[model samples]
Target: MDALFILTMLVVICALAFDFINGFHDTANAIATSVSTKALKPRHAIILAGVMNFAGAMTFTGVAKTITTDIIDPTKLEAGSLFILAALLAAIAWNLITWYYGIPSSSSHAIIGAIAGAGITAAGFGALKAEGFIKILKALIISPLLAFVIGFILYSIFKVVFKNFNLTKTNRNFRFIQIATAALQSFTHGTNDAQKAMGIITMALIAANYQQSTDIQLWVQVSCALAMGLGTSVGGWRIIKTVGGKIMKIRPVNGVAADLTGAAVIFGASYIHLPVSTTHVISSSILGVGSAHRLKGVKWGTAQRMVITWFITLPISGTLAAIIYYILNLFF
Candidate 1:
C-alpha cells in the first residue's frame, strides 16, 4: 500500500526473476561436460541438474550473508529498494543479452558489479564497504585461475594413473562417473548461485524494515531454490553447446576432471562465503583439462572470447546499473 512496501515487493519479484534467469544461464556450467561426453541426454541432464541445484540451494546461507553485507550495507543505503531494483534490472538485462548471444558470461559478476554501480550512483563511492567489496572482487578474480590450475593438475594425475588402461574402457568408465560428477557440480553451483537471489531479497527486507540482520529466512531460500530449479528445467542449449564443445573436444575423462574441479572450487568458495562465477570456473576448468590432454587441443580463440566477456561484464554491468539507478530515482 505504501511506497516503501511497493518498492520492496518489486525488489523481491525482480530478484527472484534474476535467480530464475541465472539458473538457465548457468545450467551449462553444471551439465555441459556430462552431456558432451554422452553421459546423459540433454533432457536427463537438465532434470538431474535441476534436482541437484534445488538440494544444494537449500543447503547453504553463508554466501547469502556475504551478499547482504558486502559491497554496501543495506541499512545504510538510501532508497535501498530502488537501488536493488536498478541492480537487478541491469543484471537481468546483461544476462539476457549474453544468453541471446550464447556467451557464457558471469552472472555473479553482473549482479555484484550492478550492486556496486547502483550503490555508488545512489550514495557515492564512499558508501561501499571497502573491505568486503575487495574480498568479493578477489574471490571472483582468483576462482577461475584456481579452477584452471586444479583442472590441469587433476587431469594430469588421471592421465598418469590410467595410462596403462585400455582407452575405450577408460572412456566408458569415466562416462558413467561423469553422471555423478555432473550432479555434484550442479549441487555446488546451486549452493553458491541461488544464494545470491536470497541475499538480494533479504537486503530488500532489511531496507524495508521487515527483517533484521543478514540471516536468510526459510521462505526466501525455498523460493529462490524453486525459481532456480524451474529455470534449470528450461535449460540453455546454446550455452551447453559452447561450453561442452566449443571450448574443447571434451572426452568423458576430461568432463569428469572439469566437473570435479568446478565442484571443488565452487563448494570451497561457498564454504568461505565468497561468490564466484560458476561459468568462469567451469569454462576455465575445461580449458585446463584440454590443455593438459594436449596443448594445442584447447580452442584458444573461444577461450579468448570468453575471457574478454568475463573482464568486461563487471564494468559494463556496473555502468548499466548506475544509469538505471539514476533513471529509477527520478520516478521513485
Candidate 2:
C-alpha cells in the first residue's frame, strides 16, 4: 500500500479509538444514578446503556452534518492523509489521558478542539469557521445550566407530588421510573455522542480524498456506534464509582429526576445539532437535585474541582493537539 493509504487507515482507526474512549468516559453519565441507587447492578447498567447508545446512533443524522459542514472550513481541508492522522492522534491521546484519571471531560470538545488546532497549524486561522465555534461555545455554556434548571424544577415537583404518599410506595415507584429515565438518557447519548465520532471519521475521509462532503456513510455510522457501545460494555468502573457514589448519595427519586433532566437537555441539543457534553449535563443535573434539597447536601469541593476541569478542557486539548500536529508535521 502507498503512504497515503496507510495514513488514511491510521486516521480512521484513531477516530474509532476516540469513539471507544468517549463511550467509556461518558458511561458514567447514563448509569451513575441507577448504579448508585442500586436500581441496577454496575455491570447490568452498562450493558443496558451500551445497547441503547447503539440504538440511538441509528436514529439521527443532523448532528453529523453540523460537525462536517459547520465546525471547520471544508474548503481549507487539504487533500492529505498526514494531517488527518495527526489530528485524530491528538484527540485520542487527550481522551485516554482524561479517561485514566476518571475525569468526565468533554469528548466532543476535545475532538473539535483537535480539529481547530490542527487546522490552524496546517493552514492558519482562515481555515476555521468562527461562527461554528461560537455555536459550540454557546451550547457548552448554556446546556448545563438548562439541565440544572430542568432538574431543579422536576425534582421539586416530584417531591411535592409525593409528599402525601407513603415514603415506601414513592420510593418503589421511583425505582421503576428510573428504568425509563435511564433508557432515555442512553438514547440521547447515542444520538449525540456517537455522531461525534461519525463526524470525525467523515472529516478524515474527506481530508484523505475518499469523500467530497462531510456526510457520514452508513457503514461509518454503524462502526462508530458499535465501537462506542463495546467500550461502554467494558465499563469505566472508576468513573462510574465517582459519579454514582462519590458526588452524592442518590436515591431512586433523585436518579430519575437527574436522568430525565439530562435526557431533555441532551436531546434538545442534538436536535439543534449542537454537540454538548453529556457528562456536563448530567453532572449539573445531579448538582441541581442535590442543591434543591439543601446546599449542604452537595460536596462543594468535589464539584468545584469538576467545574475547574470543565473550564480548562478546551484550551488544554487545543494546546495538546497543536503540539501533536506540529511534531507530526515534522516526521511526515
Candidate 3:
C-alpha cells in the first residue's frame, strides 16, 4: 500500500458518509408535507422516497461535474486529499448538529463553505476560482427566493380557481395528488444532493492523478446513489415534525402546492447544472404557501430560527473546516 491509495479511500468513505447523512437529514424535507397531510403514511413515504431518490441519483451527472471543478481545483491545492476530508468532516458534523436539534440547515452551504475554508487553509485565498465560486453562491441564494415567490403565486391562483369547489372533496383529491408531488420532490432532491458526493469523489480521483477530466465515472454515480438510498431508509423524524407542522397548519391542498413548488425549483437548478440547497428550497416553498393561506397562520419564530441557521452555517462550517485541516496537517 501506497499512502495516496489510503488517503483516497478515506475520501471516498467520508464522501459516502456525507451523502448517507444527507439522505436522512434532507429527505425528510421532501416528504414532510405529504406525511403531515396524511397523503402518505410515514412508512410508505420513506420507502417511496428511498426508491425515487436512488432513481433520480442515477439519472444526472451535470451537477456532479460542476462540483468537481467549480469550487476550487483539487489538483491546485497542496494536500488536496486532506482538504477534501476536512470539508467532508466539517459538513457531516454541521449536518448532524442541525439534524439533532431539528433545524433544517443547508448541507449545500456547509460543504461549499468547508471546501472554501479548506482550500484557503491549504493554498491561501489566492487559490479560489473567483468566477465559478460566485456563480455557485448566487444559485444557493436565489433558488429559495424563487421557490418562495412561485409558491405564493401558485397557491393564490389555486385559491381563486377552487373557491367554489366542495372543500371535503377537494381536500381528498389533493391528498391523492400529494402522493405524486412528494415523490417528485424526493426525486429532484436525489438529482441534486447525491451529486455533491459524486463531485467530492471525482475531485479526490483528480487530485490523486487517477483521472484527468471532471467526467463522473459510472461507479462514482452508482455508489453515491446507493449510499443516499440506504440512508433515506432511515428517516429524519425530527425534521418531519418541524417542516411538516411547525411552519404552518398544512392542509392537503397546501402540501401539494408546496411540494410542486419545491420540486420545480430544485429540478430546474439541476437542469442548469447548479447546486442549490434542497432544505432551503423546500422550507421556503412551505413558508410561501403558509403566507398565502393566512399570513397570521405562519409561525414566524421557527422561520426566524431557520433563517439564522442558514446565514451562519457557511461561516461556522468554513471556520470549522479550516481548524480541522490545520489539525490534520500535523498528523499526516
C-alpha lDDT values of all predictions = 0.95, 0.82, 0.95
> Per-residue lDDT for 57-116 in model 1, tens only?
999999999999888887888698999999999999999999999999999999999999
How many residue pairs clash (N, CA or C atoms closer than 3 angstroms) in each of the candidate models, in the order given?
A: 0, 0, 0
Predicted candidate 2 versus true structure: per-residue lDDT over 1-332, tens digit per residue: 97667777887788788888888888667988998888888778898999999999888877887777676765565634565566677778877887788777777777777777777777788878889888888998899999888888888998898779887888788888888889889989999999987887777677667889666799999998999899889888777877786677789998998999999999999998888889899999998888786678788777887788788777877777778877877766
Residue 164 alpha-carbon offset, candidate 3, angstroms: 0.5
Clashing pairs in model 2? none
Candidate 3 ranges with C-alpha deviation above 4 Å: none
- Mark the regions of model 1 whose C-alpha exceeds 4 Å error after superposition: none
lDDT of 3 by residue, 1-332 (tens): 88778888999999999999999999999999999999999999999999999999999999999999989899887588989999999999999999999999999999999999988998998878889899999999999999999999999999999999999999999999999999999999999999999999999999989999899999999999999999899999999999999999999999999999999999999999999999999999999999999999999999999999999999999999999999988878
Instruction: Locate the minimum summed-lDDT window of 10 residues in model 2.
Output: 74-83
Which model, 1 or 2, shows the larger lDDT? Answer: 1
Residue 23 displacement (Å), model 2: 0.8
